[model samples]
Target: MENTRNVLDFFQKIVKEEPDVSAAVAAIRTLMNILENFGDGETLRGLSEELRKATEEMKKAECSITSVQSGCELFQRFITLTSLEQSNFKDCKEIMKKRGEIFLRKLQEARPKIARLGAPFILDGHKILTHSKSRVVLQTLVEAAVISKKRFHVFITESHPDLSGVAMRDELLKHSIGSTLILDSAMGYVMESVDLVLVGAEGVVESGGIINKIGTYTMALCAKEMHKPFYVLAESFKFVRLYPLNQRDLPQELKFSSTIIESNHSNLLDQHPQVDYTPPGYLTLLFTDLGILTPSAVSDELIKLYL
Candidate 1:
């Protein structure tokens, strides 16, 4: 249990220190730490089990673990691939540590690559509508304003419960980009004013749809009704093997926070869902490190990585 607490502490420290880092990437870094500190007596299987247990413990903590699951799973796969055909256990461990560093470097590069690809979409005088606070979305807007020298306005939702969108608005202001914070219920009202919708995802499912902060679907629906384009900015590492036909299809762990799930509240209606699914049909295009991809193209990329 002490080790579990240590693992959770490490994960939380990474998040607290680097607010821009995604929870998924923090989880990956924590797992990498486990590999780096592995003892010489530990077997390969034991190390894998340790990483698996750390992931489960993280999910139980009072935080969002939606993308963490996918990140940890992909990192585990990379470790397995690195472990193949190694006679000496010590040599295999060393190889995994080296390869893990490379994997992490690639992930760090994904955000800038995605930002560059997404920045061009924010043309001068264009108004972008984004929900919640996405590091990728934030980086893209910064890139457009700082690098591309484009002048654009942004409409951000006052994402409820956390009101993370307000922080997004403030961050934009820091970059000298004009932005407005509107109520969550005002998505339809603001739809006509914005030229396009851009959002960051917690996970990009197999259906090419996205699981993101709550109210993302509402924004997408409004964008669809108004004939405005809806774009998603996400890293390819966030692609999870989920195919949800509707909101109910999402797992409880993904929808609710760890605290809410553990509670035995008599009125279940009081429990708020942290995330929602936006179907592929509503999305215009996805800006990823892999390049601009249609909704249908997400599955192709997922197949390449997962299959």
Candidate 2:
């Protein structure tokens, strides 16, 4: 029973500490695997109940994290819950999928607010630029496109190393959406023509600032210089409570495989290329499941529910 509590605590920590979706998904899968292989029937039942509680906790945490209205206290409450083990792979997968779907539904609920912010449309076929591939952003854009009828042309940065943009570009093409793929360096040149900028956040801070893929900060800076509006399309669950007090003093860690580093043979090789942080000032508003929020207002709004 004590071991089960330890496992549960660890599960909650992974959900809280890991900012990356891939990391979170991987952690959840690991937990599910452990439960599936080792959990007894009683443990499985407990885990299912715990998962439901986690889902509820996640909803509250989302409000806190995205709105920047509160601290990490509420999320910490859920972290104290006990964990359960599972005995069946099928059951574990089903539970994870169900939880994921619930999370996605929460994201969908924010669509109306996202649409409202991008309102009055850019009539002259506004050029919107973004980097990295984001499923949430894609869904939001697709919905907007359907409503605006090709009133916007999207420019995507060919996210290097992973080149995830290619897949994104393909997906857009399938929808007959007009889009342009640009090299990361070309962002400045493209910024001049862009009317607005939109990107996805990997994690949002309590202050309403955001951490995203590398090059996002550069894009935001460029947008700031150009006096263009920059919006972040993200769900509340992506908000992470912990933050480095001194942003510049934070350790720079590698985000990708060591193989890429070992093969370079030169010290100048790319070491870290996964994500970057853009300060709150660079963003205009946060389009979240709850509503649109400004940097200063997010925390107050979040605090209403979770504090």
Q: What is the C-alpha RMSD of each candidate to the true structure, in Å?
A: 1.4, 9.0
**Residue by residue across 162-247, what tens digits does model 2's lDDT show?**
78777778777877778999998999999999889888876676677787777888998999999999988766655555354434
Could you tell me every candidate's TM-score relative to the true structure? 0.96, 0.64
Which residue pairs in candidate 2 collide? 35-86, 67-298, 68-299, 69-299, 69-303
Q: What stretches of model 1 exceed 4 Å from their correct place?
A: 265-267
Residue 143, model 2, lDDT = 65
TM value for model 1: 0.96
* Candidate-wise lDDT, in order: 0.89, 0.60
Clashes of each: 0, 5
